[model samples]
Target: MVVQKSPQRAVLWGCGPQGSEVTVYVLGPTTQKKQTSVSNETGMWRVMLDPIEAGGPYNITAASTNPTNESVTLVDVLFGDVWLCSGQSNMYFQVSQIFNASKELALASKYPHVRIFMADLVQSETELPDLANVSIPWSVPNEKDLAPFSAVCWLFGRYLYQILKYPIGLVESCWGGSAVEAWSSPTALKKCGLDYMDEKLMGPHANSILWNSMIHPLLNMTIQGAIWYQGEANTNYHKDLYNCSFPAMIDDWRTAFHEGSGGQSAIDFPFGFVQLSTDIKNSTDDGFSDIRWHQTADFGFVPNFRMKKTFMAVAMDLPDSTSPFGTIHPRDKQDVAYRLTLGAQVVAYNHILTCNGPFPFLILPDKMYVYIIFDQELAVTPSKDIFEICCSASVSLCGPRSNWVSAPIKLWVQRTIQLSTELCPQSEEVAAVRYAWRDWPCDFKACPVYSAKTALPAPPFIINFQSSSGWKRRHIATDNYLSTEDDWQKMQNGFL
Candidate 1:
């Protein structure tokens, strides 16, 4: 079987101002070819081969002759899925700091499909349009390589390699103590305007500067998508600025890396980001929660082509204690990788295995009609004591009164109650019903409280924490789900 050659292209950005004449060489599966071009006025210049040439272990070397002699080398280059991994210290954490990163070194020793390109962490008061001293090259990942590549990035790349089985290139342009604005471009900031901050004169145009130094140059390459793990920097509760500003960066990069003859494909690349988690003490402050909620809300919204193609990795469950207070670095890279990998699995492979397996989404029903909406269509084995329906009392028709209940509703069944509706106080009076209503930590103690000893009739739903409460007769929506009054009744009826 003839192997399909990977797509080939070249990208050169911020070359004009850095020098007058720069010759690029493409050496892989063929003799190196040279091209002479001056960095454009914008300091951003790009070129794409009309017909992508051969692919292999390639080398891209750049030499400048603007006024002096300068040279740069990028080795072990290959045409593949190159992703730009950016964030705070979490994404910049060293691999050696992890538990068995060294022991796992053997497995990570040879990364044929994975390569890493790093940008030195640098920030300036002025947004430098053309970063002249960006000295870094792309190299294959190995334990002996960079002392500490981003821990999250390492696992993420490894996971992507295993899943796609394609060459994965990563560009890590992150800083240990930087905010979202530091990584965003001025274009985006300017667009965001002072409606938020007098950003006209902020610290540094981090995003734009980073793109200039770290990402802009690589835009000459081919990439599948990007995975982001940031927001800790902008923890000033500017989540609104972030939610709005972050998407713009995605758009800016897409615009910068157009995939056409000399432009990137107009297609908005899939951009997946990790939620900052509850690390911030007051997520409710500054409408931080709302900010995150809105940030999340924008994922698939309107005229913005950037958001429709994105996903959010939930870190709400991650341990905040992992890192000490005032500590900028959080070292739960394994889970970060796991989370991003799961997301990529869904984004890249469409491989859905479990609710937590990745790509798990909560589908909000338009209205709670008579029909019950199962977030996931699950199958169950019928049993006499399979589950129960409860309103006020601990009603058990087939088995002992249980804390959790799952009524097996047969497909197309018109029955008001699936499991025995008896002992449910007034069946129609039942204001609301809950399955597993507790934050039973998705990790460690994820097993349901009562279901562990007995065969569970259904998967847990809204996790419950405390014992039952009473509810006087109250009307519920036609869906028969619990109404707010039930909660009030439980307290007023002295059933707490």
Candidate 2:
């Protein structure tokens, strides 16, 4: 029922008797009201209202053409930055399940101004209107509601609310065991000659069923942006298609949410995501690393006009060693939330901040080693044995997680980490290098690799030997890193 408060913004959607008239009145904070009417409709009506300031406790009254003469009024509504939180189970991880859940729940009482609009789990083949079938009411944070809310999303909104001093709307739109393709719009899939509704991909529901049931309904409503945490499900099966498919989906969602919502101008809203953390046991392929690469692609590939198309929070370093790589759902939601908060600060809030640890860029020396460079410039953490590496003659033979072993990390300068080509046998071509790329140790030691000054958790990366044909990938990244061979080439030449 909440529409973004803007000048001539869409306020409501209603159905009345065919060929009948419907009326709507929106009362803003200052008792200023606007009246709009839809005459002779095919039972569907979209009402627009004048703009209100960012914070509001406004009232809206809507009337149908039904002879019964019934009306609905929404009161104490505020105009604020609305964010769509979507993805799979990890995105749906609730507050009650996080570390110090009791403390987080108690602190929840401090941010009553933050509200949540939870979309119930639903799947449909056809596009649906907002609340077409399922009805979930918007509620402010309270003890009863806070426990079950998505923990990462709550913390994101909590931080934004406290700092920005605005009402933050958190829309929980997710489903466990769902794949990326499931949430993609049918229109996007078909355009790319893909089948978002592939029956095999669909599991139980029809193709694009979740998109129709979950996302379609909310398209008309404007939002500040979206935060995504998915790909564990797609880690193995969809990693290949992810590079192209993922970017296309972001494009599609931007179109649908902005154009479909009838905004005043085209807006390429920010879409930030969490990189897959280490989960070595469950994934049979190196899908985690491959997908992470694709997620960061948005940063490199998307133009500045897209308004920071993506902000990726590296979860690779924040795993629970006790659970080891065996557990998929790590209990460290606090780190996840804070990392995402930093990303939002830089990307969404337009703040100049160091949001990532030392991200690697490789320069292959003709002589003895490969020099790994970084974006923010780097210094070595006072930890040793942090660089675990691998090498091979070819991209495939070396294979992900194939022949990895500890390597001597030579910190030549603040901006570089060096791996001696000697790690490879005499005269053998060293194809690639990966650092802190394996699963976390079973012990409780923190991830040893970090950016020297900022100490932000470093994201996992691969540096390949760029060659004539392409970049040669020999270092074994991990099981799920079975991304296409060119992935290494892209990482080296394209992103570098």
Candidate 3:
């Protein structure tokens, strides 16, 4: 039988012999351990073994205390970092559907250490993922099994295994056309007090219903982290609520995992996710701005109740040209996985120290224009349609074709973009300055502005011009002065 390897997990199994006792033993490379438990009135006996240290290929043996010779042995037991890959149709997108599927599937055979537990769509009112409903078994990546597996998770785990050189466990728990609230726990909704969750939010297959069936059973299991690719469902309808609801849901999952593992306090495990990409349908400002903004602010506002870091892999570049407007799934998933791997490297692994694009450093409100400063390896590209300024933060002032103007700046070092009176012609007192704000109305090719040294796309942001407040100088982002973390405290507190 396959078992989850560990930081802390107690393996348990039932034995038969009505009211009999059982003895369980585990033998690893460096240690040997034993535990005992007796069967109840029913003919079932069980044992809760101790947690093993990380790194393994241990042997576990269990036998009935009665002399009848009832026993089970499991060989090549391991302790490896596991990750639960969850989300909607995007994350559930299979390897076979990708353009480079033949190549990816062929290469997947090389990583034997990576194992997956593919799951089925099961929702419940209160019941957990019962063993009887478990449809798939744990197996290594193979030509037969690789076709239907998640391309993003498989690639992410492959790269992670290459770097860490240990066994990797991936539990695929997702459903196509599911909402953000679907995977979220019920307790999270009550704690966060998510509003407007009327009949539309919970109709059996949507909202927190999946949490009881899809996410609940995996609670106590230990995992390295989770990678999510959702928001296509909720971003458009529940745009405003997502900012608070998303972070609260993340916190809830972390707490559930921590408490499930018997951590008295709480363990902050990394939770990285992919931001929503631009599409034809999302244009015309149907809530994407608010959704994207919150996805960016979550990491800064939602403090890891512990040491865990929250991160997002930007997917704005993944949308294809032909389907630039309505395209939801893009074929450039390899790049998407690579960006996620980079995020894991920085926030989770702490191996690299550089940004593909500059993060927003600060916004200095000047007389005629506002100076937008960026942090990290930034080199200003000849950005054409990358700038937009509104009279204020209200959507009413910024209509479909509002005071939208462009500020084409010259080639310079990657530090700042000056939004002059030329850009903010509608308002003398500029209320808000937005970069790459609108989803459409311009050519997709020329829209990106954050062309950093590493060429990573900068997250979309709005720095409001508060009359009372001004910019406090942080370290200038250069070789000598590097600071990617922005003073987002203002942005986090509804300042924008």
Model number with the top TM-score: 2
- What is each predicted model's overall lDDT from 0 to 1? 0.49, 0.66, 0.64
Off by over 4 Å in 2: 1-10, 35-42, 65-68, 132-136, 196-206, 264-266, 281-284, 298-308, 321-326, 377-406, 439-445, 467-496
Candidate number achieving the greatest lDDT relative to the actual structure: 2
> Order the candidates by lDDT, highest first — what do you get?
2, 3, 1
lDDT of 3 by residue, 1-496 (tens): 2344444565455546755556777877756555555555544444445555556677777877564667787776667777889888778888887767899899877887787778777787664634326545678678788788888888888888888788888888888778777778877676556533566454533558788787887765656688888877776656666776677778888888777656611366778888777666446664555676666453322123322487667776556656322367766678778778777777767786552456656665544655566765455556655666665445456543556566545333446565564555444445556666655423432345545566677766555444433432222222122222254344322223
lDDT of 1 by residue, 62-94 (tens): 777757677777676566566768776677777
lDDT of 2 by residue, 1-496 (tens): 2345454354456665555445676676555444444445344667555566676677877775545466778887887777889888778888888788899888877876788878888787677765555334688677778787788888888887877887888888888878777788877777556774454555523457788888888776767788888887777665677766667778889888777667732367778778877675433456676777666553322223333456777777666646432367777877787877787787777888777676554344434555555655565554444564455666455556666555666545656566555556664566656555544422232565567677776666555554543433232222123235565445445423
Predicted structure 2, TM vs. truth: 0.84
Model 3 per-residue lDDT at 161: 82
Worst 10 residues of 2 by lDDT: 473-482
- Model 2 has an lDDT value of 0.66
TM for candidate 1 is 0.63
